[model samples]
Target: MTNSAPDVPATPEQLRRSIADRTWTSPTAGILDGYQQANLVVVPASAATEFAEYCRANPSVCPLLASSAPGDPQLTYDGCIVDVRTMVPRYRVWQNGRLAEEPFDLTPRWREDSVAFALGCSHTLDGPLRRAGIPVAVTAPPVYITSLTTRGTTRFDGAVAVSMRPVEDDLVDTAIAVTAMLPTGHGAPVHIGDPAEIGLADLASPDFGVFPGIGPNQTPVFWNCGVTPQLALAEAGLEYAATHYPGHMLVLDTVVAA
Candidate 1:
């Protein structure tokens, strides 16, 4: 059974509309349940092949979803016509290794050779956990950073950053069982102990989002997050690329075709 939270709408149309209009540019993690969410990377076609190769070499971290052919904003192969320019809640456009706040659209800087890539995301795991009666704690969406360094595919290099969730110790096993079946969702826990073990010096200070302390005896489990790709982008110093603002995913009807 899937989770049936009252606030989780039967359809994500409302949420998607809000995002497209730029009215709701916040995180989309908990707004919709069961739907697949993806991280995005839109870059020039000059880098698409190498990036595709990189994705192939590193499937656990950067699981690819859909991609539009060159110059196409329509991700139609998956029948999900995301407006690459505005469908996402927010965009992070980078130039020559520096990061900017958020770009509502990439019209001005849209590369003629640009292509987009979607990666599988961790939010896909939360639904089943909630249904299983596992207590998955979150102030909103758990934006987290992993302490492990991803095996970089060339210029991409950085520690994997993951969202944190406080799982009750007893439900940890069930949560693992539930998530393992979703192979595209980074599989299962990458680490399950003190944040310090993953080089996370403290739980209070995450690379993103608010961090509430782990409850008494609750365990901190980590996963091979999709944000791994964004970190890789940041590390590579790619002159032109855009990623969805962390936690602000593309809630698509398309499942992870991986």
Candidate 2:
């Protein structure tokens, strides 16, 4: 909800701690510059395997980072420890495929049968893109459910979700090349130019996140969004589930190679 930048800690651990303490609750788009940010998907142990398979079938949008053992709240990757219960700034709790609540922490909702999966987030590339002289939005970009359907699993099937960024015509290739180096950030764009080609009719109104407004001479570039799993989760009608609210990622100590 809030787009204004809050004073953030210098390290990822500190950032996580701050988030846990409720000191920071804004979206993680442009903050914490180089550290990797992860999209979260916590499901029951019964659906974990199928969900993991779903991620594998759609790597572009769900580049699996790390998963936690059932009933465990922690996920470790490259020496970084992330507590799924409290580290993320916000969480979306789903019940039977319907979004039940948007909570600041998952502590109360964490269950004995819960399994958490971390997916690569496009926010990880924001710092690199900005450093490359490309103007990046401070808040999360608009996300739309496209006509493109992801390769699905028995329990998970849905249309692909993409986040759109407006890039100057000249910087389009530079933006692509810069992001391509980091697969962990949903590397490169999935679509460019016309939004209708991707089933996006109106850029002004998005299915998720606020539209950042495309300017003249700037082309709309779309990337496979980490939010894709939420669509699957909705379609699956799972009894219980949790995910990072769009753009509110778990900051990881590991930096993506750019």
Candidate 3:
């Protein structure tokens, strides 16, 4: 489905209110420019510690942002209160590690033992990339499950997921440098040039998100994506879990420096 631009509010809190009210449910890219965006993961209290450890083990793919105590619907970062069940535009419900449904509000499925986690999203780097004169794709970029595996904890172990963006051949270095400074945004490109080296045979067909074709002078650069946790959740095969839909992230009030 194509995403249409909505009337964006001036602040992250306002945008979040719109999202909670179902006024804005599209992929949040290029909106709320300087604010940090985050990927969401809600799991049962039983698996929360293991999942948290798994994220810490692989910082590039899952940069830990903030986590909520079990049964707590809210996550706070930068003194901003984020209601995990309502703040996100859309959520993917997982049953037995499989995607069961995509829901706008997670309230119906919220469990008393549920624990929510927020991870750094690469979307936070969009402003810096644009300021560096790099072209960022208007649509969500393609994400692939790589052959490379992540350092896993007891319950979470699986291949890493990487998001691809076509960068001008000349600005590849700048892209890396610009993103590296923002550790909260998944940092820098993990792979560059060949997708096959990472087991992506067809660049045209990605495992997730849309594939914006590469330009003649552009090179495909891959970054460790927040979606990595989703793959791990599937691998763990938990009875129930939840995550933000790919590209639809939780907009945070935390202001990031470009």
Candidate 4:
């Protein structure tokens, strides 16, 4: 369920401070318009190299933006200072391939051998899709795990994750065109029409976020999602791993150029 809180943060800095202050512990969707958002992933030094390669092998789903040196909580998005420990609204701690806790901060869990990665989110292209007359809503898009699996890297293996957006039939082409312009943002629709063709059994029941309905004359569009890495981490079963809670993401100072 979406947070029902009033006065949602409106600017990138305001949203970052709200998260840092622990005042808003909800998904970052619909928060700062135009600025890019990212999926967060922190892993131990031992698993960092393999994970980085995993991202490279699966660029469409995990377009890496920046990565930090081991033991560093500071990310490398030039021109902006972002503290990975607390700038994201919510974080999911993982242990032995399972979710351990959803915390507002990761200071207690940071490790000297930890390395953080910032991956581009499809949300970065929502503005262009909207301006192009495709109604890409700001609310969380429904994500589903497909039978498809990544070309397994050293220790990473799992099904692919795809987020779905229902587009009016007439605008589906426009949605594809606009989203394709942003290569870093999971460019283009991987699947356009049937959910079953992609192994999505039901639309109402999703692996993450609220299920969006497919209205008459609308088709459900699917895109590779940054959440794909979370699945790989689970399969890798590292002693410890951390990621942004699905839907909750790190708001960035960068913008997706039109």
Candidate 5:
């Protein structure tokens, strides 16, 4: 879990070049180590208010790490160090309830009034969980279909998506306790039993990303996934919208504590 490369201490440029060269196509959890990685949600100006409302209604699911002003793809930062337009590894351009394209960068799809949002994800807790010797059955963050309904509105409505972590039964309590120390990362498990109870019929069939293998002694612990907003956005058929591929999150320069 401690994937700290002093050579690449989680910078925006490193991410930009990595994506440009197509050297990084998979999840981003183990790449940045302790640095927090955030999920992305890109939407048009017209739906910004409705999307904001959805985020406000379900803070834990979205967390709302940062929201850009309308017409801006770059997040508000000093000297413009963090560019949401090209930093994430991969992006999903969704329209009409389906993915239109999966691009490595936004140069081809950038537009005015497209607000980019960064939300908390379970990847923030991966370092701690792996440090505890818990064999994370989840190789990459896996989004699960949930029975929980996100507080919806006139513009968007959808079921919640949760990330699963399979922990040993005896270690579940400790795992929860450790992540609780980092509340900004959608801390703790929301559900600890069968996925069927959460409306998910199978663990192998995730709506997005690769599925993690569940071992005999492991139990799937569910946490609110940041993808919840992207799902709602996709469900609304925004005509034009982009989201970071499920596990590819932005690595922030600052540190987050519980």
Candidate 6:
């Protein structure tokens, strides 16, 4: 599932340009190795208050990175500039509790009252995980809708989503230790070993992304995923909303993890 490229941009800005110019439209996993990537979610100004609270209530799954002012596409944090309308490689437009379309650009759908939110991405820990000898899928890792729901109000209450990565039995501790230091990147594993413990029926079928190959002596490790908010947004029955395509995250100019 690797988005293999011999000329992958080396810097965050360069990578963003590649995405902006449509040179790279794949998942951001394993790209801009040390930088923090983010999940994009845009909602109308009317829903911003509840959505912000939802993120605060579910910090592990919806860690807020940068939120744009209504009608403004610019989001700057840690010296990085994210143009919400074009930074993401893919976007999912939601309407009335359903996904309306998956588009590469948001210009046509952008609204004057839209507020874009950047949620911390789990891909921020991929480098640390790999450095610790834990294998992360090259493409977007598999995500699941957990039975757990956020402590949000009626407008934002929905299932908690988690991303899965298979870790060797021996390196589970190492993976946990390494990712624990990255609070912005969903931190440590919320569940380990049994998938059914968290209501996951099969690892082969995921709510998003491709199923990772788990070898012998390896067990599935789960982390809070930024996609949690998207599920909530769908349940909220908003008139219109948008989010990054699973794994097509916004690479930022910040080192979130070692």
Tell me the alpha-carbon RMSD of every candidate.
4.7, 1.7, 1.6, 1.9, 4.0, 2.2
Candidate that beats the other on lDDT, 4 or 5, i.e. the better one: 4
Residues 1-258 of candidate 4: C-alpha lDDT, one tens digit per residue:
235454876678888888888877877666665888899999999999998898889888888989999999999785777889999878899999998998879999999999999998988877777777777778889899997888786788688999999999988888888888887778998899988888878889999888878899999999999788898888887999999988889988887775
Ranking by TM-score: 3, 2, 4, 6, 1, 5
Error of 5 at 28 (Å): 0.9
Give candidate 1 misplaced runs (Cα > 4 Å). Answer: 1-10, 137-147, 255-258
Q: Write the per-residue lDDT of candidate 1 for residues 1-258, one digit (tens) a residue.
A: 122223433566666665666566666666565777787888778778878877877777777777878888766425666776776777888876678657665566567778988887788777767878976543344446655776666676677777677788888888778877775566677777777777887778777767767888788777777667777777676778888877667787744332
TM for every model, in the order presented, reads: 0.87, 0.96, 0.96, 0.95, 0.86, 0.94
Candidate 6 to truth, TM: 0.94
* Candidate 4: C-alpha lDDT: 0.86
Two-way TM-score contest, 3 vs 5, winner: 3
Candidate with better TM-score, 5 vs 6: 6
* Predictions in order: lDDT: 0.71, 0.90, 0.90, 0.86, 0.75, 0.86
Winner by TM-score between candidate 2 and candidate 1:
2
The numbered model that scores best in TM-score is 3
How many pairs collide in each candidate, listed in order?
Answer: 6, 0, 0, 0, 1, 0
Instruction: Output the TM-score of candidate 4.
Output: 0.95
| Model 1: residue 156 alpha-carbon error in angstroms | 2.2
Question: Model 6, 64-142: lDDT tens per residue?
Answer: 9889999999988787877889889889999998999999899899999999998888999998888777777677788
Would you give me the overall lDDT of model 1?
Answer: 0.71
RMSD of 1: 4.7
